[model samples]
Structures are given as structure tokens and as C-alpha cells.
Target: MSQDQSDKGTSLSLEQILAQAEQDQSVETDYQSGFVAVIGRPNVGKSTIMNEMLGQKLSITSHKPQTTRHRIHGIHTTAEHQIVYVDTPGMHLGGKKSINDYMNRTANSAFADVDVILFVVEAGRWTKEDNAVAKKLQNTEQPILLIVNKVDKFANKEELFPFIEEIAKEVEFTALVPISAYKKINLPAVEQEILKFLPKQNAIFPEDYVTDRSTRFLAAEIIREKLMRTLGDEVPYGATVEIEQFMFDEDEGRWIIHALILVERPGQKQIVIGKGGQVIKKIGTQARKDLNNLLDARVHLELWVKVKENWSDDARALASLGYNDNYSS
Candidate 1:
């Protein structure tokens, strides 16, 4: 086995290691790699920008505010560089009992160890909330890039200049990039700015690898995304998906996945199930389709709804839900 594979603790089946070595040898001699954290308020298109940067849906995104709860890293490798982009939860003003407070802390924590911070903003308006967030970015030691997303809505460049100036006055940004994350305008410029900030380090992840998250975690996230999209308001925010069992039968070429949709209360459970299991059935069908596409095989997905009262507040439940004090800022 190659040294790299061994370091990853993978006892690759001889054939795999040789194939990987051949691919590794073909990589460019001089390569740069680093991490960039994307931070902004809810619904500013941070996830959308990360997805566009990687040229794939590495992060789950939706129209609802604060869709991303955790810090998800998407690695983009080129012949010259490997950029591990971290998509963080949105930063906003928080209340003592509010989950939004928790999310804001998560977003700010990404700035601690990253090389660059991409501060995304909505193109149309700059609210007082936007100014407050910009002020926080000014205090960060790392290089900050002001990215004005949703610029496609603007009719001309002149219309965007005022908002751009307002942000620039607040923070000493490394670069101010106006791009539409949805429409993918001026994305090449964003990529160029990312390269400039990246450290001169060897590639941390193998060229073929895209993310650090497991297939199961991503599957659960996709299900959560569907829940966030289809189920309106509080249902999506208050819910979490946990995979109880995931067994892949190599000989049979099938995957058996049993997951529990955990909610805070019985009333929320009823909403998820809907009238006669209609909503959950729809959730299952959509989730299965996504699973099949991601796994490249048939998936026998079994979903069960369980009410765990105050799962967010319970320490053990928070740990099980993938939230720990270590993740807190």
C-alpha cells in the first residue's frame, strides 16, 4: 500500500492503491492548499456560493432561512491548489432561548482557524443587521472577501456600487466581488481571489476526494433538505435525521437504511406524518430518489418518526444530533 493510503488507515485492496498511485503521480509538482470559511447572515447564499465554487452540490441548500446548521467543508482541488471551503451557518442577532443564537456562534467559530473568510451579502438591500455583521468581520485577523450575492437582480453595475461602498467602509476586505451565486456570474473572479489567499501547502485530501462527510451523513442531510423545502416554517428547523442502521450488501448490491426523523414534540411528529402519512410518504419517496442517485444503486429506506421532547436542550440528545459544546463558539 502507498504511504498516503496507509496514513488514512485504509487497507486498500492492492489494486486500488496502485491505481491511486498512478493518479497521484499525474498531479502537478507544485500544489497549494488551504481552508476558506464562508460566513454571512441567513439566506445570503453562502451555501449556494460554495456549491457553485466546487461545481457540485456538496452542501445542502434551501430557500428557508438558516438552512445550514453545521459547518460543512467542501474540498476543491485543481492541478495547482486544493481549497477546502467551509460553508457555515448564518450569523444574526440572537436571543437567549433561540436556536438562532446557537447558529450564530457556529458561524463565527469558523473564522478562528481559516485562511480566508468570504462574507456573503444579499445584493438588493443592506439592513442594520448587515452592518452589524460587517462590523464583526472587521475584527477578524484573517483576510476577508466581501461577496455580494444575488447580483443578477441588479439591472446594471451602477445600481450595485452604493451597497458595495457601504460594506467596504465597514471592513478592510481583501477583495469585493459582486457575483450571483445562483446565476454563476463573476465566479471566475471569486476563484481567483480564493487562490491568492490559499497557503503554500501540499494537497490535504486526495485529488479524487470531494468532501470529508460520509455518504450516510450526506444522505441524512439531503433528507433534512427535503424536509426544509417541503415542510413550511418550524417543522424543518425543529427536526433532525439520525441513521439508526445502514448496511450495504456488497454481494447483493443493495443498501438497507433505517433512519429516525427526530422531532421536539408529538404535535410536530403529527405534522411530519401529515394526514394518513401523506407528508412522510412524500419525504420518503423524494429521499429515496436522492439516495438512489447518490449511492448508484437501489436503496431500501425505512423512515420512522419519533418525538424526543426538547431534543435540542437535552445534552445527550444534542450530542446524538451532532451538536456538542466543542462546536460552540
Candidate 2:
């Protein structure tokens, strides 16, 4: 017997060892999959990058900060690999309340058990706040990919290189990619670099699955996103969307969704409803369009704005708004 067979004793052969190794490798190759977390300060276009990467809007985008409060997973699959992207809340320095603390914790938690960390930075200007964030990311052991977003707005790319180089000096990154998520430039290059770090593994999600959030969850988020965009800063930090009812009729080919827009004060409620209820109507119309597209069915969306003072501080109100105190693991 050969030396390999001798090591395996009389029960095994060299061919079997080689075959098992090949099988393992095959499994690994098929399983080219891993989780990647996108982190940055608010309004850095993290959501834009994720949507562009997946070619869908799994996470809502807005100009306002703290749009994303939870960790949302967007899955992308190909014949060779599966990439699960985790979209997190924008990290900020400090806030007085527990909710702000929760948001910060949720963003930081995405770094754990992730294969790649994409640190998104605004390209137009680099602030001291951005530098502090870069330092925190540099402390992580996982591969970091520095993505400078909004590059299209830059008048001179040469002026931006110094900021990029400064960040590079702060941390060891696998790659530094400068691209505009809004303009969709150099996105393919970013995807390719992310793929290189994922391990081979079977698909963790169904092929058709795009997001881990439920339809109700998405509906609430879409409503809130429209409110954010339309109402702008008039909406307070404590405002949230609560789904009162979500029902579908297969025979009728229609979905009936009833959601309430919870605000911190009565004045804010009036702001959401607008003059002659026109503002709420617009928000409903826009949300319904998104819901129909997401659900692929006719949607009847009913929205109501109500005053729920201090919802952010009220534990019961927070839970009703899907901000479970136990969300932190």
C-alpha cells in the first residue's frame, strides 16, 4: 500500500482522501457566501450603496439622518456565490436618550461575525467626525473596504485623494474604492472586491428572497420614508409608523393595509396631515405605489396620523413601534 493508505490503515485509500478533499472544496466553492456590513454616519448614502449593490431597494433611503434604525439584511446570489449585506444605522457620537443609545449599539453590532466591513465616507468633504469614525473602524480585525461616496459631486478628484490617503494611513483596508452610489459609477468594482473576501458556502437564504423584513415591516418603513421626505424636519425624532392592520384578499387580488403615523405632538400630527389632508394624501399615494411594486399586487393603503407624546421615552410605545428593548443581543 502507498504511504497515504498506510496512514489511513486498511479501511481507507489515498483515492478516498483525495475524493473527500475535492468534495469539501466543491462544497466550499458552492458556498461562496458571507455577511458584509455597511457602516457610516447618517446621510452618507449607505442605503444608496446597498440598493445599488443588490439592484433593489431593500433599505429605504432619505436625506435625513437615522433613517435606518435596525439591521436590515439584503441578499444577493449568483451561480457561484451568495452575499448577504447588512445595512446598519449611521454611527454618531452621543445622544441623551436610550433610543439613540440603541441605534448606536445596533450599528456597532453589525461588525460582529461579518466578513467585510464597508466604511462609507462622504467625498465632498471630510470632517473630524469622519476621522473619529475611521479610527473606530481601524480597530476591527476584519477586512475593511473604504468606499468614498458622492464622488460625482466632486469638482476635482485630485483634491479628494488626500482625504482618501489620510484615511488609508489610519487603517489597513483591503481596497479603497471611490464611487458615487447615486450616479452608479464604479459599483461593479466594489462588488468584485467584496466577493473576493466571502467564503464558499451554500446559500443561506432562498434564491427569490431579497430581504429578511416582513411585508408589514416594509410597509411601515416605506410610509415613514415618505413622511420623512415629504414632511422633512417637521417630523420629530420620536415619530414612528405603527401597522394597525394588514390583510390581503387572494380572490380579490388586493391588499388592505391600515397604518397609523405616530408623532410626538398634536402639532406634528397636523404637519403630517397637511392643509385639507393633501399632504397625507400625497404620502399615501406614494407609499401605495411602492407597496404595489414590492408586493406585486393591488394595494389599498389607509394612513392616519395620531399624537403619541413621548413615544421614544415610553417603553410600551417603543415596543409597539417595533423598537423592542430586547433587540440588542
TM-score, each model?
0.87, 0.88
The segments of candidate 2 whose C-alpha lies over 4 angstroms from its true place after superposition are 1-30, 325-329
lDDT string, candidate 2, 252-285, tens digits? 7688899998888888888888999999999999
Model 1 C-alpha RMSD to native: 5.8
| Pairs in clash, predicted candidate 1 | none
Residue-level lDDT for 68 in candidate 1: 91
Compare the candidates by TM-score and give the number of the best one: 2
> What 10-residue stretch in candidate 2 is worst by lDDT?
1-10
Scored by CA lDDT, what does every candidate get? 0.78, 0.79
Candidate with the greatest lDDT versus the true structure: 2
- Measured with C-alpha atoms, the lDDT of residue 155 in candidate 1 is 85
Residue 253 CA displacement from its true place in model 1, Å: 1.8
